[model samples]
Structure formats: C-alpha cells, structure tokens
Target: MLLEKINGPDDIKKLEISQLQTLADETRSALINKLSKAGGHQGPNLGVVELTVAIHYVFDSPKDKIVFDVSHQCYPHKILTGRKKAYLDEAHFHDVTGFTNPNESEHDMFIVGHTSTTVSLALGLAKGRDLNGRSENVIALIGDGSLSGGEALEALDYAGEYDRNLIIIVNDNDQSIAENHGGLYKTLKKLRETNGNAEDNLFRAMGLDYRYLEAGHDTAKLVELFESVKNIDHPIVLHIHTTKGKGLPYAEKDRERWHAGGPFNIEDGSPLYPYQGEENVIFSCLKELLDTNKNAIVLNAATPMGLGFVQGVREEYVKRGQFIDVGIAEENAVAMTSGIAKNGGTAVFGTFAPFFQRTYDQMSHDVCLNDSPATFLIMSPGVFGSDSNTHLALCDIQMFAHIPNLIYLAPSSNEEFVQMFRYATTQKQHPVAIRVVNTLRTTGVDDNTDYSVLKSKIEQSGSKIALIAVSGLLTMALEVAEKVKEQTGNDITVINPRFVSGVDEELLVSLKKDHRFVITIEDGELMGGYGQNIAAFYGDSDMRVRCYGISKAFHTEFKAEELLDQHGISVEKLTKEIIAALRSE
Candidate 1:
C-alpha cells in the first residue's frame, strides 16, 4: 500500500507528486476502516485526509510544526506520521487517543482537545523559535468553525502585525460539531462561493495576506498551494474549502450526526452499539419545563445535541425564542443568562462540565455577584464524565461551591434531578447551578424534599457509624450500609446530601450527637469537594471523619466503576474499611 511506503515525514517528502494522491486515498480508507469500528471524529478526520497528506508532503514537520486546532482533524495526520497501525489493524485500535498528544509522537505537537486554541499555541511556538534565534515555519491548522473563539481572533489579529514566519491554514469544511454560526461564517461562505476573490475579505481586513483553494480534497492542488507559500516572510491565511464527512454518503448528507460518535456500521451508518438506557431523564424534564414556562429561555454553547435538544425539538424552541445556541463560546452564554434573568426573563444555561470550566469568572462575576437567579445545568461532572484530563471536570466543586450567591445542587436519582431542575428554574432568590444526574438509576418514588431550606435526607437512623453520601454516590453508600448491617446487624445511618454547595450545618451538627464515626463519600476529588466540607465541620468534634473520593490529581482513561473502587467508594471496599475502623475502636 502507498500508506505503508510512507512511514514518516521524510518518506512523504521523498514521495513523487504522482503517488501523493494515492497515499491520500489510502489514508482516508484507513481512517474509515478504524473509525467505523473504534468510532471517533469521523467527519473531521475524513475531511482532512488530503490536507494532512499535502502538509506533510510539502513542509518538514518537527522543524516546520503544524498545530491542529481541536486535534479532531489529527487522525489523518496520525495515520501519515507512523501511527497507521492503530487505524489499519483492528488489534491496535485501542492504541492511539482520539486527539493529539506530544508524548505519543515527536510529530504531534500539543495535547489538544478543546476548540480554537491553535492560533495562540502556534504563536507561542513561533515566538519561542524567534527567542532562540532559530528560523522555522510555524503553522497553525485551524477550522473555519474555530474562528468564533476569542483566542483565535486575538491571535490572528496579532499574527497580522508580527513580522515572522507563521502559516495559518483555515480548513473550511463549513461545519462545526453542528452547522457553523455567527456573522463571520457568512463572510466565509461568500468567499467560498466567489472562489476566494470576494471583496472586503475578513483575513485581509485583519492585515494578513490571503490565498484560497476551492479544491481542498485535491492532493496535487493542496501540495502546490502549500509549496507556493512555504517559508513565507510574513503570516498568511491559506483558506481551503473541503467537504465534511467527505467519503461517506450519509455522513456527508448529515454532517452533524457524523461529527463524532460511537462505533457504527460501515454499510448504513447505523450505530453498532447504541445507548440501551431509558429515555434521558434530564432531556425529558427540560422539555417539560419549556412546555410549561413560557418566559423560560434555555441556552447552550454550541453543544445543544449532547444536552438533549436535537434538531426538530431544538427548532421548535428556537422559533419560540426559548432556546439559543451561543456557538462555541461558554463565557458569553453564561453572562448572557445572567442578563436575561436580570431583565425578567427566565434563563437557564447548560454545557458540558469541562466546557463550563472556562466560564468560572463569568459565572462568579456576572451571574452570582448580581444574584440573577439564572439556572445552570452542569452536565456529566466528576469521575463519570470525560476521562481526558483536558476535558475532565473533577475540580468543578472547587470552582463553584466556594463562590458566594451560587447554590450548587447535586441530585442522587432521576426523580431528584427532576425536582432539583424544577426548583432551580422556579426559585428567584439566588443563582442556582445543578449538577445533572450522571447515573441513570431512579429511586422510584417522587422526590418531595424541600430544597428551599438546604438539608440532608437521613434514610436510616443509627448510632456509632454515619454515611454521608453526595449525589450519585448515594447508591454506593446504601449498599455499603446494607453490607454493614448484614455483617454486624447494626443499622448504619445513611444521609443523602442533595445540596453539595453548602453543609447543612444544623443536620451536620445533629449527626455528631448519635454518630461517633462519620464517613463522607463523593464522586469527585476529595479536596475542596462536598466530603471535605463535612470533614472540616467535624475537625474539632469527638466524631471521627473519613472522606472518601478520588485523589486530587488529573485522572484519565479510567472505567467509572474501577475508579470508584480504587478510591474505596465501592460497597465491598467501604464495608471492609468500616469493619476495620469499628474493630480498632
């Protein structure tokens, strides 16, 4: 195969111009071959196959570094740069990560996952090369969708003024995770329609020289484009138009559906392994909330699909001015929610917990400080969320709970999540942020607990041992309590702290009366989490407090159950530890 012939950047550089297109073909085949079974950013990687080949064929990587924006398009780049085994062979499918990593290969520059960071990171590389008095072509390969980010805009502006060798490759596939948004995309569309000869070009207006190629999939043309601008004296924008999900028919027709997902059938693009869980509890509840509350507005930053607003359902709310997509900018969505609430409109903003990390300042200053009563649904937090350290939101509690005027609620079950979501949206007293239920288990009964007054629910009362489990860990706590009862015939008090932000001081103080031994368990990190607060409250008390949670570290690629067991949050481990603690006394 032509792909096998080319092992590294050197091999690609030695390849004849005629053989380059064949290599691009094999690279795309390899991308599809693995992605169909392993599943990843299928459309983004497939769209960039020819582009990836062209860059490696022209420029010397490691010397002339190219940084992929979100690293979603790096799969083709990986296949070309000596990592083809992971894609071409199913046995090695679990080898490489879905994103870029410097540790994996010298060819890979940074460990990137989030969007719109390439320009700034590439600028730093260029600046470093200049500082060391070394001359190397530093290239930033960003998507047209990433142009909406403030970092990309700021770096692009600075690049126009910096007199250095920087190449900005704008891979325009005309799609973000969903369809592209904002005023700039319209200008990009104009440029695409006009064959890049449009007047008042955005890049040119930013004082950067520009060139465009409508044939982004053509290997020969792409190589020629890169060769024409190699070692340029100033920064230039190479705008290349390509089709997202290029090789697949259904994927090309529906780009958003093919953007990223689980393993799928190569024949009809049907999911090989689909989610077998019941209908999402949060999505259904949110739909009900919108159906009833006319003034309520739900907002998300680019990831509307993940948060349960799919096309037909989303369009209905959009037409009603009840749902808005802020387009890959979380900071704006958060502050806007606060403004909407201040003006008498009911506002709720939700995004992935990892993405919400960027809005800490906005959530604190604009929303909480003003006490706007905006509701935020922090989705998939703690160990249950994304395992990537870049996207892991284990430290979410440290960011939120300490902030004044913000009430952060954590729900244990489906019913609890529904009730909490209702309370957060209805209450006008403080800014509320609810950590959405990660576990799919339901407690069966309707949750009638009053959240207006912050408190804990004690399921079973007992002396000597008290278990304070936070949110999703409530299930684990109950099992541990049952295990203790089965072993010692002593009922262990199980307390469910629905609200994670504050300690129910009255309830906590009352626990000290009967509970000689207190064990706190949470799904996130032990430090600055819900458990630690309980430990701190009992620091001076006669009660012995032991907080159980994952260590304060950047944990990645771990199974949910395995991570819980490692932290001694599992029923068996907790039961054994409790029995030992009791024996010591």
Candidate 2:
C-alpha cells in the first residue's frame, strides 16, 4: 500500500529512514513475487533493493544520472520510479525489462546488459556535462564482478586522472553470475574485512578517493555515505559490502544458483519449472580430453559456468592445473590461450558471446594470424538467444567470419557440438570457433559427423528456392520451408550451413543451376554477416540473394521470438516473401 502511493524518487526522498526500511521490504516482496513468476535476475535485484532505494533517496535521478553496471539490479530502481505495477502485477510484468533501458525512462541513462561498462559510460557523461557547464552529478554503480573487466579497469584508471564530479559505487556483493574470480576480488575481500584499510587498494591505486561501509543495507548509513560525496568536486569510490540474495536463505547459501532463473515456489523457493536437464556435452568432452591428454588446458573470462565447466567442474580441472579463470579480462584470456597453444599445450578458451567482443585483436592476431590451433567455444551466439543488446551476440559472425585461418562451426545439435569440440581439441591445423547455441537437444551421443571436412548439410532437398540457415535459426528455416511447400507445392532446398566463417563455394555454385532465389537466414546482424558473404559470392551471378537477420542498430529489451518476427524472420513472413519473389519472376 505504501509502495503504490509512492510514484517517483521525490516520493522516496519524502520518506523517513523507518519508512525507507518498509519500502525496501515491500520492494523485496515485489521482486521475489515477480521473479518467482516471470523468472529473471532474482538474486542481483534482491540484493540491491535497499541500495537502489538509498540511491534514489540520496541523488536526484534523471538529472543526477545513475548508471547500473550490467543493469540486472535495476529492477528495484524500476519499482521506485513509477514502474512498480510492471513487476508487482502479473498482467503488466512484461512492461519492464531485466536491465536498464534509456527508452524506458529518463532515469535510465544507458542500455547496459554486459558487465564492466558503467564507469566508462558514466565518465563520458560527466565529461559532457562539464563541457556544457552543467553541475548535475554523475554516478556509476558497478559490481565487484564487473571491476575485473578490462574496460571497467581502464575507465577506473581514466576517472582517477580526470578531476570532476563523479561518484562510483562499487556494489560488493562478492559474486558475479558465478563466484567472483580474479586478483581484484582478493583485494575486495581484504577491504571488506579491514574496513577500507586493505593494502594496495585497487581504487586508491587508480587515484580515486575511497570509502568503505560494512553494512550496505543500512539506509541511514548509506544515505550518510552518499551525502558525504554527493557534491564532492572530484571522483570518488564508495565501496559498500552487502549480502547477495539477502532476504532468501536458500539463495544466500548458494549465490550462483539463484543468480537468475524462472518462476519458483514461494514457500520453499523450489523452482516451479522443471529442471532444463544438463546434458553438458562440451564440458564432458573437455573433461575427457583433459583426462586423456595432460598437456591440454582450458580458459574462461569470468564466465566459466557458461562453458559447461561450472564451479564443481572447474575445480576438477583446476586441480589438474588445466583450467584457468582469467577474470573478466577477455583480451588476456584469448592471448593466454594462444600462448598455451603455441607452447605445445592444447588450449581451449570458453566465454559468453558478447564478452568475446573485447578480444577482437587478440583473436585475430594472437590466435588466428599465428594459427595457434586454440579452440574457442563462443557460447550463446546469434539473435535467437540473448535478447538484451549488451548481451546479444549478433555481431560475432561479422567479427569472426572475416578472419583468415579461422574455422567457425555452428552445430545444429549437441552431438555435433561434442564432435566438433573433440576435433578442435585434437587437431593441430588451425584455430577453431564453435558458435554454441543455448539449448541443443542431444541425439543420443552420436559421433558420426566428421568436423575435419568442414562443410554444410542439406536438411531438406528441393528444386527451386534455396534456404540457407545458420546455427540456431535452423528450426525456423524448416518451419518456413514447410509453409513454402504448402503454398507452392514445391519443396524448398533447406540447407543448414553449419560453418559461417568460410563460404561453401562448391555448394553455392551447384545451387545456382536450379535455385533462382537464395535466402540466407542467420540469428546475427545482417551487416557483414554470413548472409552478406552469400550475397557477395553471387554478386555477378543471376541468383537473387536476400539476407534476413538482426538490423544494424542496438536492439534491447525484446522477447527472442518477437525480435525475430520484427526482423521479418518468421515462418509466415519468409514463406510470403518467397511466394512473392516467385510470382514476380
């Protein structure tokens, strides 16, 4: 009842410390209830409930810009800023997003989903405000997990030298999506224990003023801390220690499991949805390889869990000195994998799709150029997967496909992924990239596919139009093909181009004889993607090529299916387009 009456930050500012605690409690209830039904970043948002409330109470939002790192914790901020109905009410829950969105409100400055960008973006905004002679404060709320990232560290270094009104809040819940890894976490632990007296303080070393608070959830103390640095004429770091999954006991015990998920039972916190089933072929293959080959090593950039080697899996390999968590430094991870590979050790680096963007140079020069034979498991690539722009991997094809000596493989099934992983690890010929889909139903451990050949597969044979689908878009393409068949009575050639980096020239040339129109569908960006290459390959030829993929702009806060349909990648859209093209002829 109190929450519904409050509309904005002004309403929060009017509340006393006692009321603020009540507000925090209500916010937590709203968050847990919503996430229990809609499924989202539960722990992160729950942990930051008090902190976000304190922030809105202390600072003037929309004017005093607050940037949330990764923005997963912005759910609380959304609740306080006239968006409570979106989360509290079931019918309106879909109205709000999981991350901060500039389109959603003036309060949200940037569309952030990936980690380690808040500091840099905040600094730029602060600099712009200074240039225009505006006195509004700029605050960047970052997490301890994100601090390990190269970009965040770089921004922290930059903020250190530039003297301006900037407040950086380090939300030290002590866990990333998984347990926080890296040397900086050690420093954070020391700072937490000693109350800011830690030697070799990371923030201080970067030349920014540092202050620590042990109880981050205390509204009065947090308000006082913010008041101390609200109008400070220089950059400062406010290190506040808080408990992740604070209100939930089960979540508190195992922070990683409760990081994000679907609806769960409110009584015992048991997941309402059935377990997604863990058939981790990639990690199993890696484990087998490591068991057989002593010289093989694995590397991850802050997301070891994404690669199938979670905490327990990682420890098994780490004991053998084959697994390394290189923190959020992706560039370093790529280079390190290259080094290990070149030094006669079989090396494989695994990370989330968007995070790999940080290692373009290293992936190209250190790994591909040298032809180190390092294996890269690019997890959750293409548009059908992660809906958030900051986390979307739509540009991976554009980035990796052009690289020479790089062999990129997109597996349609889990069986294929396992085979490719094994082949990539054993082969010493060239650097290999596996564009991993989020969910791939295993077809009962069949190692029939030979990845060494590196060619495309025709899922369905036909005569006229050729439908080339890549990675996760295979199913969509097949559905479109069925619709095409119903409309024209002609079976369209549905080909799954499992490899995107290189063109299957032989297959393309062969199709030109019968297929008049070629439609390339990918769950990545249309610009410089696998589709473009197909278009360019048939530039002089008579084949009419149309590419369907995500657009060139940054797309955020969308359902995967809705986004695909919006991009004209649905079964009906593709079928209709094909019929029209045939009729025009």
- The runs of at least 3 residues in candidate 2 whose Cα sits more than 4 Å from the true structure, single-residue gaps closed, are 439-449, 460-462, 476-492, 557-562, 565-585
lDDT of 1 by residue, 39-74 (tens): 888888889989999999889988888899989999
TM-score top scorer: 1
Backbone collisions counted per model: 0, 1
> Judged by lDDT against the true structure, how good is candidate 1?
0.88
lDDT of 2 by residue, 57-176 (tens): 989998899999989889999999989998888999888778888778889998788878999999999999999999999999998488988889999999989898999999999998
Considering summed lDDT, which 10 consecutive residues are worst modelled in model 2? 439-448
Best-fitting candidate, measured by lDDT? Answer: 1
